[model samples]
Target: MTDHPYNEMPRSDDNQSLFRPVAVGGRGLPGNLALAPMAGATDGVFRAICREQGASLTCTELVSARGIRHDPGWARSWRYLAITPAEQPVAIQLFGADPDDFDYAVRAVLEHPVLSSAFAIDINMVCPVPKVVGTGAGSALMRDLPLAARVIRSAVAAASGYEVPVTVKFRTGWDAATADTPAFARMAEQSGAAMLMVHARTRDMMYAGQADWSVIARVKAAVSVPVFGNGDVRDGPSAVAMLRETGADGAAIGRGALGNPWVFAHAAAALRGEAPLPPPDVAARAQTALREVRERAANLGEARGVRESRKSLLWYLHGTPRAAETRRRAAVVESLKEVERLLADWESSFFDKNGAVHFT
Candidate 1:
């Protein structure tokens, strides 16, 4: 609602005219709101929802560069790279530090004809999880600037024949005490990265304290490529606040979009000076949950998807009226049919008179 420098940017449509794109690469990205590459959470199905909800840009979950090279099954993991024509301008995110391995992975992604339609391919250098960094991939690459720069230059060169731009997503640093976000962002820009996404927290923070918008602002100031400020953007107003405060060209939404993909549309609307709506009603919420579950099941298959979806299903139900009770009921669901049955019976009671999730 507040008109600030960040809120002042014109909202552009999807690739229609010469209007500046959201500036993902050296050019505009078309859609300003981007979906962050959450490991298990940002799969193809969920990405479809966020795209439908008005996210102009979306990224695949972080894929291992090493896996993409060593394992034939690696292509299977790239299932998240599956994109329909509707969701154009998607970015497939990859991780790993080995220059040779990264070169191979870049070639692998480019070989797929379907992936050519993407706006760009992003390298992830900002994951904090031990499993990822322990392999010297993800945010670990940040500590080794020479290797990180080499990876980007090499990936870009390998994918040079293709038109898709190459970008990087990274953290502030390992921790607050050793923050290198400002310096590294500049380095990536210098090394030919098309765009830079600053998560605004050091790896150590790991979604802990508030995302340092100031650092995001600093990165934006330091880099010429469009800098997308991420973290703590849980709703429309927060998106506006970050945009205004940091003057970032765009925002990358993560955990906030967990059970609420509508955030993309709402954020787009708010940036254009529109009113934000309340969270969806119980029926709508249930429908969304059902769709998400069904899609996950379809992608991952019923048995595995059902089991893997349990935690997300719980996240979707969080803060709903009788959510605890409903989740308790949902916990026993052993199959897709059971999940649907439980949701059907309990949808109505989830919304209170005030139109919020009921606690009881």
Candidate 2:
């Protein structure tokens, strides 16, 4: 069991084990749980924390091939792909429509000291953010299967020689209005995708509505490569249900992980058919958040760490009382002392809803 610091981690009995090792491109992932590459979230620090909590694999935030080609800041752009020895089995996810750029980017990444730690390469075909779609990247790739194939072939060619597998993550289609993922999945497999992840919703659906697991089922039927089901998976039961419903090799955890890394451990246990563990109580959450703040401060420095803490900090207190005011303070506070003060105030207020504290 991991040194969870708060709760007693559960053990997996052989009979109840829901997970077995999964192989991707000749590399075996310890388990099948993956962390989705959310743009503003899942940076190196957060990725390290989540991996420590149990996510078996993680991909970087989407890097733009065009940016890699023209921007002198390309080195800085690889920040999301930065890895420590502990964050192994990470993938470098890239986005763009230019096949040439895909080739150039992959080769360049294979040589970068910071990014050489990637275990695989993943192309993003599921982003719904208008900027990404308008540029004919992201979900736009879904509309042009031929262009998508070209991009994948280029990336695969560049990496296959090095034995680095390339994967793709995509949504069903533009929306519920059209679902073409089965055909798309077949094309990607033929194009040399080592694995695939289906988000189970259309690009137009964004993160809304229920993720249609039937689409994952369709994609799994369409290809021989491993398929991971994404979207709407919040915890252990949902993770197990995704694999069972679609016959997917595994499930990907996205928004469900905000402020809760333990979901990975719980999901792993739940896969084994164990009881779903209880959520962290207020004090436990407060303490964990405090530790994360220290990690952030040490890794990212006080100013940026404190500045960014507001979002994740608020996420930790998502449903608790006095959350609104704390969110406002967390948004701009600039010191570990300030963060500690806020956590201290919350601990005092955890049982006293009427209690209030003001930031200095």
- Point to the candidate with the largest lDDT: 2
For model 1, residues 118-182, the per-residue Cα lDDT tens digits are: 67889999988999899888988888999999999988887777866889999889877777787
**Mind giving the per-residue lDDT tens digits that candidate 2 earns over 87-160?**
67789899999999999989888877867668899999999998999999999899999999999999999998
Q: After superposition, how far is residue 279 of candidate 2 from its true place, in Å?
A: 2.4
Q: What lDDT does the true structure give each of the candidates?
A: 0.78, 0.83
Cα-based lDDT at residue 319, candidate 2: 74
Q: Model 2: runs farther than 4 Å from truth? A: 1-16, 73-76, 351-360
TM-score of 2: 0.90
Q: What's the CA error at residue 84 for candidate 1, in Å?
A: 3.2
Question: For all candidates, what are the clash counts?
Answer: 9, 3
Q: What is the lDDT of residue 120 in candidate 2?
A: 91
